[model samples]
Target: MGKSYYYVEVESLAGETICLQLPNDLQGAMRAYRQAHPITWENLL
Candidate 1:
């Protein structure tokens, strides 16, 4: 297999703070992360 590079950046102020290091397909990683950790009212704090 060959190595590939991908870059993804979203303005932090747009939503919650994410400190994840996603090296895979950004869309897929984000989808999985959101599915695993859905935001709730308590998260706002």
Candidate 2:
């Protein structure tokens, strides 16, 4: 088994951070964040 980390979701500038249990799959979270945030391919490099 792997260890668990924490995930924080910030909706607004003044919004409180929503904490959740982060599974070992970081790729999923990155993908989800990329879709939600305005991230470019170049920035990921």
Candidate 3:
């Protein structure tokens, strides 16, 4: 079976919290997430 990912909603200063999926390797997802949402570093947490 393929790997499964878990997600959780996190609050950010931007306003609406987001549901993030945790992948086995975060590098690619991190890149894509930043590109899709241009939030500050702090907002990323």
Candidate 4:
């Protein structure tokens, strides 16, 4: 069986929207997004 992939849409500080292919579920995708971006917990809300 093949591993499932997830699409994570993220925005950069430059205002460019990019789609990332993550090899994980929603929780994993969120973790990847937080690692790739410089956003804090406070910034999320």
**Clash tally, candidates in order:** 0, 0, 0, 0
C-alpha RMSD of candidate 4: 8.9
* Candidate 2 C-alpha lDDT tens digits along 1-45: 553344555466787676565565875766556667755732652
Q: TM-score for model 4?
A: 0.40
Candidate 3 per-residue lDDT, tens place, 1-45, comes to: 643344668789978899988665875676666668866633775
What residue runs in model 3 are displaced by over 4 Å at the alpha carbon? 1-3, 25-45
Candidate 4 lDDT by residue in tens digits, 1-45: 643455668899999999987544565656555667756732552
- The global C-alpha lDDT for each of the candidates, from Candidate 1 onward, is 0.50, 0.56, 0.66, 0.62
lDDT of 1 by residue, 1-45 (tens): 543333344448778655545556564655555557777522422
lDDT, residue 23, model 4 = 48
- lDDT at 7, model 2: 59
Error of 4 at 30 (Å): 10
Q: Which candidate has the highest lDDT of all?
A: 3
Error of 1 at 17 (Å): 18
- Where's the lowest-lDDT run of ten residues in candidate 3? 1-10
Worst 10 residues of 1 by lDDT: 2-11
Model 1 pairs whose backbones collide: none
Residue 6, candidate 3: alpha-carbon lDDT: 48
lDDT for 21 in candidate 4 is 77
